[model samples]
Target: MGLAYIFLTSSWWQSAFNFLSLWLLDVPVNAYVTLFIVNGFIAPAILCWLYSFAMLLYEKIKNKILIPSIILFGAYEVLLIILLVFQPSLVGTVGENYIVSRSILTLIFTIVAILIALITGCILSYDALRSTVPEIKWKGRFLLIAFIFLTIGAILDSFSWTAIFLVIFIKIILIISVMSYYLGFFLPAKLADVLIKDIQ
Candidate 1:
């Protein structure tokens, strides 16, 4: 997920890659073209991550919904890739710094991505929260918080914020999201015990 957003948000890297592409192919690269390449990569990576995360949480649960949901979303991911390749215009208009238009395809992509993240977060946090172990419950708390930060940061990032402080604030939220994700999985036992004393 971090990798996906880095490519989406990094104009510096995009500019550098554009320069390199122009130098090599004598073709100018606009933001839309750059996004085309990055989105191709990001789409699958996000889907794979979602699947792995879901599997990690839902492995033992005999839920019939998980497999079908994965398949459905996987098809959506493929459709996104096809649209990106064949009908780039439907996605958005080319712009100097970013896509000039937010078409239905873009909206659908964002919605799907957010939906997957939300579902994963809910499942993981709910499963952990219901665990008998105090440590697991605390981990669920961090995971829930992490996903909230992540969702907010991602949504804010989708907008083109001209204000520097908003950009910085979004990055800070994402950083905290990552930290909370780490703690969710590998929180020190002592720290967990300290924080979760009431539960114990």
Candidate 2:
């Protein structure tokens, strides 16, 4: 949806402002835009998706802890819709580069939604890490770290493609970490023991 927004809604620029364009003085506008859309918009959207799945899993495993987390994340999703509707950005004439989102309500909702998502996401990850099942418990820790880096990368990467590449490099390492878990799950138990050393 967000990517469609970028391609479908093309507009001329007043000095080409994107989430990262202001800070990144040297990079091309296309790189800046690509990073902003990929990291800033798509990343949070993916988090929303993963969190929803996490809620379902946690509900089965940890119902008591799941309730508040669901509520917060649900509210976060709702506000995210509001943000999408408004489409935050700097757009206007040369002298007056005002915000594209006109309603202050939308702005406030976006900020609040971000805060709710962040806090509850970290909490949920922590609770998941506390599971007594050794496998789940350790995976939970990795997930918590992944979410933290994902969130940071999502926000910071928007400002520059340099940051985006850095984040991607880090996440690639994380992907390898995660693949070992899958290997541990699917491979022959004896082989798994040898092939997949414990990461956490």
Q: Return the top candidate by lDDT.
A: 1
lDDT of 2 by residue, 1-200 (tens): 22322221122121245435656765434532332332234224434444454555555655555456567556655654554445533211111222122234433433444344456556655675677765555555555554454445334322323344664574464455344333322335564344336543
- The residue pairs in collision within model 1 are none
* Segments of candidate 2 deviating more than 4 angstroms: 1-116, 161-200
* Predicted candidate 1 versus true structure: per-residue lDDT over 1-200, tens digit per residue: 44533432342244467768778998767655665553444455455555566567555652464566567667765776677678876665556544334466665676567666766777878989999988998889988888888778767755556567886798788778778877888889889878888655
Residues forming the 10-long window of minimal summed lDDT in candidate 2: 90-99
lDDT score at residue 4, model 1, on the 0-100 scale? 37
Question: What is the alpha-carbon lDDT for the whole of candidate 2?
Answer: 0.42
lDDT of 2 at 49: 40
Task: Give per-residue lDDT, candidate 2, residue 65.
Answer: 50
Measured over all alpha carbons after superposition, the RMSD of each candidate to the real structure, in angstroms, is 4.9, 9.8
Which has the greatest TM-score?
1
In terms of lDDT, the poorest run of 10 residues in model 1 is: 4-13
Q: Whole-model Cα lDDT per candidate?
A: 0.65, 0.42
